[model samples]
Each structure stands twice: as structure tokens, then as C-alpha cells.
Target: MSITSFSFPTSIRFGAGARKQVAAHLLEQGLKRPLIVTDRALGALPVLAEFRSHLGGLDVAVFAGVFGNPTCSQVMDGAAAYKAHGADCIIGFGGGAALDVAKVVGVAATHEGDILEYVWDHPQVRAISNPLPYFVALPTTSGTGSEVGRSSVVSENDTHLKRVVFSPKILARMVFADPELTLGLPPAVTAATGMDALTHNVESYLSPAYHPLCDGIALEGTRIAAAALHTAVTEPGNLQARSDMMMASMMGAIAFQKDLGAVHSAAHALGAVCDLHHGLTNALMIDTVMAWNYEAVPAKFDELAHVCKVAGGGAAFVPWLKTLKASVGITGTLASHGVKPEHIPRMVEIAVKDICHQTNPRPCTAADFERLFQAAM
Candidate 1:
């Protein structure tokens, strides 16, 4: 086995009204000019306004260029905004897309060449040796857990192929995880994003990695998500449910430092090829892939079943996922979500090439990916 490293070092202030501390914290650090990186829709919402109201003393500029799946172009645009406003720090606001883009905007602003040149797999990937502007995160959605992530996933503007810029340098300096920020999420968005958090916990736990610490976090994260996801979706105003889901989301992100599996590979492929929401793709593909994975790690599945309170142990785990999906109103296949049969081959190619599946308990081939997509459809 290869040597592994573990870290969970992000400073997090988790509770209701945590967002109110952002301005004072930044001010104490002497950061007066801050750029707010968020999605256009969220920028127009009362949430953004309320958050800004807390920063009355700071000079803040808004860059609401992020939308849908994040793209390299969006990062470039945000960098331009950062430069234009002479912003000394970044405040990431909104869900995963906005936060992912926010993570890399500082990289582009400080480095030469296009942001894509900094992707980890680039032939001449740029080193991030310069100090990045101080960045803090406030997530308005309890999914992806991008607030605590050390990497950013951005796609090519024209190709829609995803690329990753993986570096500890991009990790937010602080995270204000206020569940109150998520109170206005619609039930459908809540369901899909909650499933994403669950998938991260589930896939990381099932990964064939030798990180016991991550495995413990993943199992507990799975338990938290399983207990709160449905209630979070149905009762959007339930602060306790929102808080649990938020914690589960961050825990999933933290645990996945050990790595992920086929579900993430497949979800990344769907995000790239079908332009589907990452969470929805995960929700659609998780059970299908897990069904195929069950035989490889029955003991792990049994543990998962115990955590989720599924009866009949390992054999019941996949069925429990299916039931959970339906209960959350995520009822349908990939085809129903607008993924076409013709999309399978391209998605398979992408999934096979993704780094995430290398750690899957059950090894996946191109053929296996094709079958998973078809079965998911």
C-alpha cells in the first residue's frame, strides 16, 4: 500500500448567525476590500443582501458571473472582477459552482496564463507558490461541501470537459457554516443536494483506501445525512435538519481526502457530457453503481446498512438507497433526466479516465461504465 497523509485543518464556525461574524473577522485581519463571488441568482436574492448588510464597514464588490456548472471562463471573469475592484480578499457565497469558481479566481488573478493551465493534469501545470488573497466561504446549499474543499472543479468553456486544480493553497481560510443561509432552498434542490452529500459519504466509505480515520468520518457522515436528508428536503425551515445536513456535507468533503469511487467518476462524466447538475447525476447513478459494487465489499455494505438503519444488512443497502431517492422525489433514471443513449459512450470514456474510480472497491472498466450508464438509464 502507498503511504497516505491525512488533514482536517480548515477553521469552521458552524451554527446559525455565523455569517454575521465574517465582516468583523475580515476587518480584524485588515482586509477591507473584498470581492463576493457567487451565482447570479443568489446575488439577486435576499440572502446575499442580508450577508452584505453584515459587512457594512468593508468595501465589497459583487461578481455574480458564476452560474450552472462552473467553467474556466467564469474564473477568468471573476479574476478580472477582483482586479477591477482592487479586492484584497474573496468571500465565496452560494453553492458548489460559485464556491469552486471562487477558489480558483485568486489563482488566475495572481498567476500568468489562462486558469486552465493550472489544472493538476496539465502538461505544464503551473505551481501556486505566490500567496493567494485571503478567502472565506459561506455555503447557501448543503451540498458538495466546497466550503472546506482544497480543490476546485471547473470545466472548459467550449468542451464542457471538467478539469481540477487540486492544491491546499486554495482551501478557504475560514468557513462560516450557517444553516440559516440554507433555509430558503426549494425542496427539489434540497433533495438533490442532500443526495450529493450522502453520495460523497457513501462513496468515500466504500473506496478501497487504507485510511481508517477517513472511513470513520465517512461512516458517521453517512449516518448524519441518512438521518436528516429527508426532513431537510420536506421541511425546508427545519434548522436542526439543515444543520445536520450541513455538517454531513462538510464531513463528506473532509473524508473524501482518502478518495472517492465510481459514483463520483460517473457523476463527473454526466456533468461534463450531459451538462447535468452534479448532485442530480450522483442521485441518479448512486444506487445503480452501488448495486454492482455490493458483491466486492459486502462487509462495508453491511456497515453502511447498519449506519443507515437498513434491515437485512448488506443485501438491503442498495434497496434502501432506491427508497431514499424516491422518498426525496428524485424518482427516475438518467434518461428521464435528459441523458440520451448516445451520451453513454462519451460518458463512459470520461468516467473511465476520471481519477476518482481508481479507488473504487470494485474495479471499473470502460465496459463496466457503459453498463452502469445504461442500467442507470
Candidate 2:
């Protein structure tokens, strides 16, 4: 198999068996005792067991308490595990939630006070001044791209509201992207996560940020997702489609360094108030949010239409999104996914306060978010 090594935002080793390089990579970084962070479900899978077997003679431990929509407590627990095991580095070995927790744990392990004290935007929180243990990310899914991101989204244990821990120091030292790891994902998960990747690309491109480099990357990422998401969902064993989607997902994360828009703002709110999967929330709300947003940036949608190969430019893009969502078996309204009318007020409150809304092509208000939530329902 051909392997490619490159760095856009982080060092990446991309190929079919890139995960097999994890041991050597860790050794190169002088990590002898590494703590593997992953979700409980994935930790139980044979794939992980098989992976562990490959690390002959190295000290390794697993922290598998990470749950969906990871909480700050999980980060603390993982950090405790890191210290107890005398780990020298962190290996994030699953999807976004697991990887995010691992990133936070890496920082929290070395810092003092509660983990929340380091959350972004908290006035009392101290800056993350200390360098963290080395991080090596291995993504088992082709979305979120948290493996390459510098922020980790953790939810408040009491309120379940999403909070971000942002710092350039949190970026991974190395990313081992292996498409073979994603081949076992269920179709629904593949579809939802693929749409999440698409949303990232679309929202980043539509953001009003003045970064031409991110604009070009976001546009190409959109095209790659539009072309490969369906094939990856329908043919789970197709490594080529999986590879393309993985590349698109990484590009989307890199591009979003420019900024994201209302789609993520709304999705983060949903994840907070409704306890929904981040990517699935993005997938379900994308059409309604983009439809309302099209008038604000019609020219961007026109460009998006061309990239997505839809005729009629801006007017056709929403329909194209609907078509794409349906073809990949992603069908639902917000209410169908457990959101309620009474929840709209709080969701709107959280959404407008989200940092993502600041970069929206058109400014959004609480009222606008309420309407979007209503329409989504």
C-alpha cells in the first residue's frame, strides 16, 4: 500500500494501514508508556484488541469511560488514569468524542484546578501555559476531524451545555488516518458523520472570514464530500471512497480554522439542550438553516452549487442537500429526533451565544434561531 506523509495543520500519515504505524510513531516521539483514550463501545471491539496486540513490549493502558457528547468529568477521570499509569503520552483512538476527551485529558493532566477552569471564555479560567504530553490521534470515523483540531467540545455535567476548550497547544503531534478503521461503521453512522463533514465544509466556505486559503480548501472539501459520501455509505468496504471522505473531512477541519457559521452554532445548541449526536444534529438541521441563510449569501450558494454540481446555482443547492441527505438514508425532522417546542427558547439562547454565530454570513438573532428551530421541527 502507498503511504503519504504531509502536513497542512498537523503531521499526518495517510494510507490503508496507517494505524499500524502507531507504535513506531509513538516510539519516535519517545513515548514509552502511552494511555489510549477511547469510548467504551469501541474499546470492547476486537479491532482495538487486535491493535493492542501489535504493541509488543510497550507499556499501554486504556481509558474507556468516554461517552457520547463527552463531559468534563470524563476528561478528569481520563487524566487521573493517565497519571496513575505513568503515561508519557496520549493516543486518541476512536471517533470525535473519544478524541476530544483525550485532547482535554492531555492538558488537564498537567494543569491545576478543575478542568472547567480552563474552558474557553471563562473569566476565572487560567490560560493553558504548560505544554502537554504528546498526542497521537487515530480516527475511526471520517468526520469531526477532532484528531487534527485544536479544540475539544465538552459538555457541562450539570446543564449538559456544550463548552469548548480552545488552545493552539492542544493540536495533535501526529495523526494516523487509516480508512480501514472506518469500514466497520454502520450505514446510519457513516451517513450522519459524512453529512457532518459536508456541513463543516459548507459552513466554513460560507463564513465571511477573509481567508482565501481556507476558502479554496473549503470549496474542494465540499466537492470531495459531495462526490464520495454516498459511495462510502453504500459500499462500506470501498477503501477509495472512504479515503476520499477522510481527506475531505480533514480538509474541512483545517478550513474551519477560518471560522464556521450558524449551522454549527445551531448544532452545538442541539447537542447541548437535546443531548443529540453532534454530527447527526448538524445533518438534521442543515437544510432548514441553509435555506434561511441562502438569501444572506446567495453568491456563496451559487458557487457551492457549481462545486456540488447542481444546476441553477443558489436556488438548487438546498434541494441538492435534501437529495444528498435522503440518498444517504438521513431522513428526519427535529421533533422526530426528540426536540420539542418548549425546548426552542433555551436552544435559541444557547445558539446565539455560540462563537460560531459570530462568523455567520448574515448575523443571527435569538428570534431568528427560534424561527429556524421551529422550521426544523
Candidate 3:
């Protein structure tokens, strides 16, 4: 149930006009027809219009039926369109939802049966056709680096639960992380999504893995998020800050391959039940989870404290986090997101099932999830 090998995508282009070169990249991948998967907002925007214009007379199909947190049904629908239209590739052109949907569609279009059947430790089905068409990830808001990463988190509405489909090959044949396109993200979304990136780095850094490379990547990613997240929130037009945040977001995904801890375990569960913003949910429980882990990994926190100028121990970390949270305007409790205490039991059960819990520094049982949920409350 564990992997000792690591592999990443070979094609990723990052810069100012990376997305604008989609046509060229698509051609390079030998994609005759591409399904551009995006959300309603981006699908309706002038950016999409520009893509259409650029792809004039080309065999291009657009499927924008994406929910905030992607569901298996959504991916199924998208897969149908992809099959019907003979899409030779998938262009994930929005935030995590779009990217996640595109990843699932690519898998479902070729694989048989329900998506959840592919969960790790018990992959009901396995193997994908070599050169399984093309998947080009063009991240706009840059929270969940579904671009270069190898897993997709899709919500199963029947259970109000999130499931992970893991594989490095899920990464796009190419990735486009352009900051210019993200200049339009609202301040609130900027704050929430940026915090999501911070959570990824923190969780990955704390994961009890032997990968020094991931550890280094996670720490640097945290530093980048800490330094740039607030500025990106307050000033959307700050290209420099936006660019840094975007890179930080990508770094979070890259690092987390080593491991993730309780924050992710909690947030993944909370996200399904409350349907809260993933990043914001993580932010709500981050400090709390860190405090819980203080005893298990004090040296890790101490290192993070020094990296983030947190100073001292548990006492210093909380206040420093509060200051940063306020700076990004992310200071809200779970109740603010309409969570009810009565729902804690079921929530804990789902959180315990998430694969992210497996890599957590400390084992989190159902009781642990309930306790963490209570703390976030």
C-alpha cells in the first residue's frame, strides 16, 4: 500500500503568457480536439472568448459543468461529452474544481465503473492506456495544484464525502501556471485559496516521511505563502505578489507528495459535510491541528517557528498565526460557515476514511476527528 518511487510530469510551462500559448502546446501534444474544462464564471468570461477566437475552426469542445468541489457525477457528464465529441485531450483551465473534474474525466473516459472504486489500498481497477491523450493544466487561481500533482479529490454526493484518486500520471502532459490570468480573483477568494496553499505546505512539512526533498520543498513553499498571501489578498493587481502566491500554491502540491497531516485530514472531512471552502476550512483548523501535533512533532513546529519567525513554542505560534490570519482576513470559525455540532460524529467518520489521514504524523481515529472538529468550532 506504499510506494517507493516518485515521478512528475515532464512538461510544465510557467510565466506571464503561458496560457496564451495553449494552441501551440496542444499541437505539440498532438491533440486534434481539446475539451477545455473550466467553471461557469471563467467559461463565460472574455478569456474564454479569447480562447475560442484563438481556436477558431479548430476541433475544440467546452464543458463547464463544474461544482465548487467536484463530484463524481460531474466528471461522468464531462466524460460523456469528451467521448461523444472525441476530445483528444483535456485542458483544465480554472481552479481546483475544474482541474479536479478534468482529471477524473480523463480517468473515467477510459476506465470502467464508479470513480470511488479507484481509491488507494483497494484500487478496484488499475492501468491506463499509455499516452492516454493529453491533459494540460492551466491554473488560474492556483490553490490546488491539480496541474502537476498526481491525484484528484472528487466529492461523492451520496455520502457527502471526498475521495482521492492517486497516480502521478494524472498530471497533465503539460501545465500552464500563469499569474496574469489570476489577477481577477476577488480578495476573499485570494485569501481563502492562498491559505489553502499554506495548509498544503504545512501539512506536507509535518508529514512523517523520509523524503528530505519534500521536506525542503514544503518549508520553502510555506515561506513563499507566508510572505505573499496577504499582499495578494489586499492588492489583486500586484502581479509580483500574485506570481509568488501562484508558485507557492504549486510548491504546496509538489511537497505534499511526501505526506500530509491532521489539518488536511480534518479539512477533507469538514469540506464534504459542510461543503465549506477547502482552503478556508483548512485555515480554520490549521493552528488547532498544529497545537494538537505540538507534542508529537515539537521539533518540526520549532523549525517552522524559526522559518516563520513564530518564536518560542505553542504560545508564540498561535498568536503569530492569528496575526497572519487577520492580515489575510481569514479569521472565521466553522460555525460561521453554518456547521452544527450534532453533525460531528458523521463528519469524524468520513475524515478518518480519507487517504490524507494515512500520512498524518499522528494517527487520527474517529474520536480524534470529533475532537479536532470541536476545537475548530
**Clash tally for model 2:** 0
Superposed model 1: Cα runs more than 4 Å off: 1-7
- Taken over the whole model, the C-alpha lDDT of each candidate is 0.94, 0.91, 0.80
TM-scores for all candidates: the values are 0.98, 0.98, 0.93
TM-score of 1: 0.98
Each model's Cα RMSD = 4.2, 1.0, 4.4
What lDDT, from 0 to 1, does candidate 3 have? Answer: 0.80
Model 2 ranges off by over 4 Å: none
Please estimate how well model 1 matches the true structure, expressed as its whole-model Cα lDDT.
0.94
Model 2 steric clash pairs? none
lDDT per residue as tens, model 1, 313-374? 99999999999999999998898889999999999999999999999999999999999999
Top-TM-score candidate index: 2
Clashes of each: 0, 0, 0
